[model samples]
Target: MVNDIIADERSPVSASGHAYGEAERREANLIYEYADHLQRHGHRVARQLIQIPGEPRPHRTDLYDTSTNRLIEAKGTLHREAVRLAIGQLFDYRRFLSPEPALGLLLPAKPSADILELCRALGVKIIWQEGGGFTESSGG
Candidate 1:
């Protein structure tokens, strides 16, 4: 199982462990850029480690922006599978969080319209990197 690691309050999630694959490197960069963006906007971003009743390990959120009451799960790609994984992760992370917070999917770029609509229906915000900033589509 993936370890639910924690990030320092001052930094975003690190690559951790050994070396990173090409894909993993991209994801790590995404997190760092996103974290910086949040900080620039005066948002408090941190990662949460949650343990389930029967789980052997905890789960970690990609980014929890307390400033906006938002919990985000991020992926490096806009592929259908990546978005699907982020959506599921957001739900799982939200379940164990107090005050729940709004859910968001963080991606390298915008997804298809259908995916955005699905997220809207499920009340999951879509956040994507655009130019030097980020674009957000609030959930329904």
Candidate 2:
């Protein structure tokens, strides 16, 4: 089932992980893990590479599910400030990859309700850790 879902060229796990900054790379790994989790549940998952024209370079999305073609931007942090920063980054990514509604997953350290609310208002989906792993409740 997992193998079937990830049978695509854009799947993240299908290719080698990028060599981002230490912290960024760690966060990317977590997103990859979440993608693996979703794949285990029989969902097709892919990762997007976002490149804003005239920008510094391109940034990769946490995960993108082929089943739903849902673009997910993952944010992880122990501090509220860091989480906020991640949210901002995700928003930027969404804008760059406009037209497709993006989902934000808060891992380990969750974002505040205010941030979550903002995401809701902006039509960005939210997912977070509940127990042993993460779960998606909206933006299917």
Cα TM-score per model: 0.83, 0.63
TM-score quality measure for candidate 1: 0.83
Error of 1 at 108 (Å): 0.5
Top of the candidates by TM-score: 1
Q: Tens digit of lDDT per residue, candidate 1, span 30-135?
A: 7778878777778777788788889997776677887988888878778888888888888877888889889988888888999999999999988888987999
| lDDT of every model, 2 decimals | 0.77, 0.61
What clash pairs does model 1 have? none
Off by over 4 Å in 1: 1-20, 138-140
Residue-level lDDT tens digits of model 2 in 13-42: 333575345555456556666777777788
**Which regions in candidate 2 have their CA more than 4 angstroms from the true location?**
1-26, 96-99, 137-140
> Which ten residues in a row are the worst by lDDT in model 2?
5-14
Candidate 1 clash total?
0
lDDT of 1 at 50: 86
